[model samples]
Target: MLPLKGLSVFDFSTLLPGPLASLILAEAGADVVKIERPSSGDEMRTYHPRVGENSANFVMLNRGKRSLCADLKQPEVVERVRALLERADVLIEQFRPGVMDRLGLGFEAIHAINPRLVYCSISGWGQTGPKASVAGHDLNYLAETGILGLSAGADGAPVLPPVLAADIAGGAFPAVMNIMFALRERDRTGKGTRLDISMADNLFTFHYWSIGSGTSGGGWPKPGAELVTGGSPRYHVYKTADSRYLAAAPVEERFWQRFCQIIGLPQELRDPEVDKKAAIAEVQRRIAERTAAYWCDVFAGQDVCCSIVTTLEEAMDDPHVIARGLFDHRVKSGSVALPALPVPVAPVFRSVAEVRAAPGLGDSNQELLGTI
Candidate 1:
């Protein structure tokens, strides 16, 4: 009895944001029917370095989801989806704004069929904004929200982050939260709702530190000038002498004091404005003198919130992440390890395995056609 177990989601999203959102739902027990194209499939199949038929990007997202291939432009296929929409609790679409309306499968069309259906539109800029139709990715969204400018590095330019922050925050996080809220609302009103979440617009929340830098619009320099964006030594990455990086965060006075004490720095270096840079530089120099393994031992069992800059392989064994069970590997066969999810049963379906792999273009035609 996992949460969202019985609920069926018609997922028309591809690439990242929408699919990931639906994946979370699927992980939570939503019967997610990934409605991909009959030919090329979701653009994600062709994305990244391939890994044994599964795209690294696709597998990371599409686990526990069912595949249903149908071309919306074709009347027969559209009819099939329309039939499915009648029984669907949610419709997750990541296409541009007008594409749905063009397909005659917009919110109005679906609401007419199932008034209780939660319709979610995930996009880079949002559905109604002036920039909604613009083609953009995580970088574009981050740049638009002024968050990117804050992450300046030693080169004095914006640093490229490793995650799809905008897509995750604005698109996925909001999408799931919004749909959940709508589910609650549906329970009360017995009707559906429309959700429009924009990745570019939501970047403001991710840049809280940047936004907190200054109140006056003219006081800020887009993003790179902000407190959280490596502007202060308190929240920056430092390279050790051995080329290992130590990610430090001593934003508070108490933590800074402890950090200074651990590294044996002068008291005057405590003030963020007057001595922050020097303090960080000193820590960098001191930490550099030792290897990451040595500092890991040094910082172990400490509350300084200081950590080594670990790579993907190193991150898997990170203590906190391990404790939380961040990566759930259930089924393992020789060379393949598929992610297993045992989502708790609530009001939703818990065991949703409708679409397994990216299908062979209309692979489920017989199964879906039988339903119609």
Candidate 2:
């Protein structure tokens, strides 16, 4: 049996963070009932690239979950939702601080009805901060937390991240982890706790090395000055003759030596005493002399920790990724078949074949409401 076989989750969240957290729980065998709005449902359902009746984003995040449509403003509907909450083991929401309180489903109100509900609230700045009411997105949280400043380009301009790092890492992952911890604690005390997950506050955890150095009297690193950022030649992206890139991350001395030998670097330049700027330029020049494919072949099966920077499609079709069964599961969206987004649940707890397609808005309304 799955770890969360008998657990029930009432997910009153939309978009990415809260939905993704509930997705993990659903994959782990929790019975997740998504409580969406009456007609609009989750906002992500209307995103571009529709798969059948739902958007690709919504389908991927909401897989293996049932949905119940209800207008919380309606008195009867609120009672129906409250009934579900009484039996739910967890409740996840991503609204602003006072929105739930205004809706009459706040933590205090819900806890009174179900003491064992693990109530998780995901927001940008948390529930009790000066900026708590300020509206923000993933980039805003990264900027506010000083993480965006760490990712500046050579021109000293901050680069916008391609992915929603704050949403997934800062919000979803922490919510799931805390929910699991709260569940375990509930098992011991027979009561659940409220989890306030602030995306901005949580993002500082990713800056552990920088924070440690600064606290120890080493001043905070300037943009593009950190070893992993771009200061070191051994850990940067180098462009190839074909205009593609090669990621060289041989940080250890042994791997660095191997990489230098493979690139045919001069003995004097191999020493750390050489000018870092000059050394980095030399490495860049040498890498640009060959095509990405040539370097990929040279680094194949080597411990030099170098690789050709591949496109998303190429990475998905990589031999190792395919062998590991990373994209083995397919979910049917009407006539179209889409690959299932991977969840971190262990294979022993859930298999790819066991994953179900996302439910339509209000798909389980009749059945769920009847039970309530």
Candidate 3:
């Protein structure tokens, strides 16, 4: 048993953000029951290219959790959820602004049934913003909040992040932290608190460094021109001789100097007379002169903060990751690879007694209704 083994959570959310939040709780040993729709269920279940019945996205994000599919529109279903909430210590939801309210499962409504429930609402723009009612994805939220604008490519279109910055960082992480703190606070006051984790708000906060840099007179990412935003030679991805990529970030002066020395670049490489483009071009040229593997070998045990760009396949088989057993395979609905939770303690068991593989449209009717 882990720290949260007995703490029950009612997770009424789906897709990337809310499910991930609840999954974290589940991983830590909370008895989290994911409340999916009676119809369609969680969209992420079939979002990706499926290997048999499971989607890699769903299985990875959702391990060690039970699914309680409910037609939340039904009065009996809503009351059933209320019953769970009455006993649960936490409730997490990620519906757009008014969906919960329409379902008569708003925080105010449910909190009346169980004032001790730590309620958390995860949304794109939060529950009360001007854009609160508007629909948005991770990219749109970050774009509106200025994070997507910064550190974007020098090309025309902005690049979407590989990971869900807003989802994991903004939604899941904060929900876990806040729920934990609230649970702790309830130890003293014996009452729970509500949380509004807006994806847009979190994105804005994620851009704090750039925001501070600009508004505070440090200068923001001037489009491929800022610290870690491609202005400095120390930070950026370069195309190597074999057409593979190498990412280098020697941020500090010493590290930058060391990187230059390793690559045989002169101090004159920083001269403005050569122009930023020409200087970067020279660096690119030098990097391209050698294969990525060659540079990878050269930068070993160096303070250069340099790394060969590992494709997803390469990352899974990386020596360091393999040494730590990070991506050990497990048979879920089928054989699957999952990243182990990066924590101090090790896991005893990796499976859960879960039924209804990601809920195939109203799969939990009998279970949920029987509970009622």
Candidate 4:
């Protein structure tokens, strides 16, 4: 049986962070119901790249979930939602601190209704911080947390991250982990607790090495100057003659020796202790003299710990990825179907792969709230 088959989640959150957390729960067999605003519903529904009747962004993140539209401002609707919360296993919200309290759905109120409800509030800063009321997004959170300052380009400026690191890593991941912890605690105490998940706060975990280095009087990390942030020749990206890049990570002594031999480095430059700058220059020159394909073939079976950078499309079609059945599940809507967004849930915990579709706005209102 699915692990969370009997769990019910009322997710009053839109967009990436909260939706993604509930999506993981839903995929693990929780009956997640998105409590969206009436009329427009989730703003993600109108995002670009349209699918059957919803945006691909919305469909991918919201698949296997139901939607219940209700205006919390309305007294009747608020009462109906309270009834549902009384029996819900979890509740997720993304509004600013006081918004839920003003709407009468805050943790104190809901905990009174259902002491077993795991209440999770996701925000950029947190519930009681000075910036709690300040509006911010993923980029703002990362920038404020110093994560954005660690990776600067040749121009000495922080480059924009390719993905929403704050949302997925900081917010969604922590929410899932804490929710599971809260569930386990609930099992023991027969009571649930409130989770304060601040995206910016959680981001500090990623800077463990940097934090320790700075606090230990080893000096703070400078952009592009850290070992893992493009400072070291052993762990950096090099451009090939064909303009493709090779992500090389031969950090260990053994791997570095193998990498030096594979790249045909001079005997004197092989030892990084001699002159780090000279070794980097020689490695760059040699890597730039050959095409990415040539290097790929040369390093195919070697333990050099390097790979030619591949595009998203190329990665999706990789033989290893296909063999792993990462895209075996399908997200379907009538005649339209697409690969399910790969989640980190274990296959053993998830049900068999099957076609599923994100629900239309308020699609389950009648079924879930008709009695109320």
Candidate 5:
């Protein structure tokens, strides 16, 4: 049996964070019912590019879950949501601090009704802070937490990250982890708990090494100056003749020696201490002499920790990735099909056939609210 086979989740979150947390739960066999607004539903449903009737973004994040549309402003609709919460083991919501209280669905109010509900609130700042009420998105959170300062381009300006690090890593992952812990605690104490997940606060954990250095009086690194952040040639991206990139990270001496030999660097330049900038420039020049495919073939099956940078499409179709069955499971929305975005749930807890498309707005209203 799946780990969360019998548990029910009432999700009142809109975009990425809370929905992603609930998606992980659903993948592990929770019966997730999304509680969206009556008319427009989740704002993500309208995001482009469209997949059949809904946005591909929505379909990717919200697979294998049912939807219940309700106008929380109305007294009857508030009672309908409360009815679902009464039977739910978990409640996930992402709103500014006081919004839920204003809607009469805050943690204190819900905990009174169902003491066993694991109430999770995901926000940009947190439930309590001077800036908690301030509106922000992933980039804002990253900038506020100083993490964005580390990601700099050649011009020294912070570059936009390819992924929503704060939303997925800070918000979704932590929410699921805390929910699991809360569930375990409830098993023993017979009571639920509240979780305050702050995307901005959680991002500080990603700067572990930098924070440690600063705290120990070793000084925090400037942008693009850390060893792993482009300070060292052994751990950086190099462009090839074809204009594609190669990520080479042979940090250890043995791997570095092997990488130098494969790239045909001279013996003197192999030592990183032998004029580091000159060595990096030489390496970059040599790397640009060959096509990315040539380096890919040379680095295959080697322990040099070198690889050609791949686009999203190329990464998805990679041989090793395909062999691991990462994208083997697919869900559909009407006639359009897309791979079920993979979650971190253990393989033993999920099945390919269990994947389903995101439900239409209010698809489960009749079934979930009929008795109410």
Candidate 6:
């Protein structure tokens, strides 16, 4: 049986963070029911680049889950939801701090109904901080937490992240991990607990090395100037003749020696005591003399830890990725079917089904609310 086969989750979250947490639970066999608003439902359903019926974003993040639409302002609807919470194993929400309390569905209220429910609240800040009620997004959270200031572009400005690290890494992954911890605690104490997951607060963990460096009197890291950031010649990106980028990270002494040999660098330039700027410039010049494909062929059999940066499409179709079965599971809507979003859950814990459909808005309202 799946690990969470009998667990029940009521997810009152929209967009990226909370929904994604619940999605991981559902992937591990929890019966997750999304509680959305009445007509418009979650804003993600209307996002750009539509697929079968809803936005592809919604379909990918919410596959294999049921949806129940209810107007929380209605007393009858609130009562029905409370009845369902009495038997739920997990509850996830992402509204501003007091919004759930105003709706009478907060952690304390739900804990009273079912003491074993793992109640999780995800927000940009946190539940009781000075900025708890303030509005923010992924970029704002990264900027506020000093993560965005560390990576600077050639223009000397902090480069915007390509993905939602705060939402997925900070908010969603931490919520899921803590919910599992809370569940284990409930098994020991026979009582559940509240989880306050702050996206901005959790971002500090990603910079542990930088934090230790500053605290240990080794000087704080400057923008684009750390060993793993763009400061070292052994761990930096170089441009090839066709303008494609090669991500090179032969940091170890052995790999660095091999990389120098493969690139045919001069003996003097191979020494670390030589001017780093000169070494980096020479490497860039040599790489620029050849195309990315030429470098790919040259480094194919070697283990110098380098790769030509591939596009998203190319990565998706890579033979090694396909062999690993990352995209084997499919999400379906009407006749349109695409690979499901691969969560970090291992294959042995996920469902055996190959295909599952994302629910339409309010698809479970009658089936779930009528009984409740």
- Residue-level lDDT of model 2, residues 1-372, one tens digit each, is 788899999999999999999999988889999999988999999998999998999999988899999999987888888988998899999999999998889999999999989999999999996999999999999998888898998688999999999999999999999999999999899999999999988999999999998989998877777787898888899999999999999989999999999999988888876787888999999999999999999998889999888899999999999998878876666777788888787777764454468888899999999997
lDDT of 4 by residue, 181-252 (tens): 999999999999999999999999999999999999999998877789887889889999999999999999
* RMSD for each of the candidates: 3.3, 1.1, 3.2, 1.0, 1.1, 0.9
TM-score, one value per model = 0.89, 0.98, 0.89, 0.98, 0.98, 0.98
Give per-residue CA lDDT, model 1, range 1-372, as digits (tens).
676768889889988889888877877777788888877889887876665665666766776677787888997779778987998899999889989988989999889989999999988888885887899889888877776766676777888989888888777888898899999999999999999888787778765644555664536544433456655667877787678888888778888778778877776776666755666677677777888788788878778889888888777777876886545434222255555432323323434343244334345667876888
The alpha-carbon lDDT assigned to residue 20 of candidate 5 equals 95
Backbone Cα, N, C clashes tallied per candidate: 22, 0, 0, 0, 0, 0
Q: In model 4, state the lDDT of residue 249.
A: 95
lDDT agreement with native, every candidate: 0.76, 0.90, 0.75, 0.91, 0.91, 0.93
Q: Roughly what TM-score does model 2 have, to 2 decimal places?
A: 0.98
lDDT of 1: 0.76
Residue 68 accuracy (lDDT) in model 6: 96
The digit string of per-residue lDDT tens for model 5 on 91-184 reads 9999899999999999999999999999999999999979989999999999988888988999999999989999999999999999999999
TM-score result, candidate 5:
0.98
For model 2, name the residue pairs that clash.
Answer: none
Candidate 2 off by > 4 Å: 351-355
- Which candidate would rank higher by TM-score, 1 or 5? 5
Worst 10 residues of 4 by lDDT: 270-279
In terms of lDDT, which candidate is strongest?
Answer: 6
lDDT winner between 3 and 5, please give it: 5
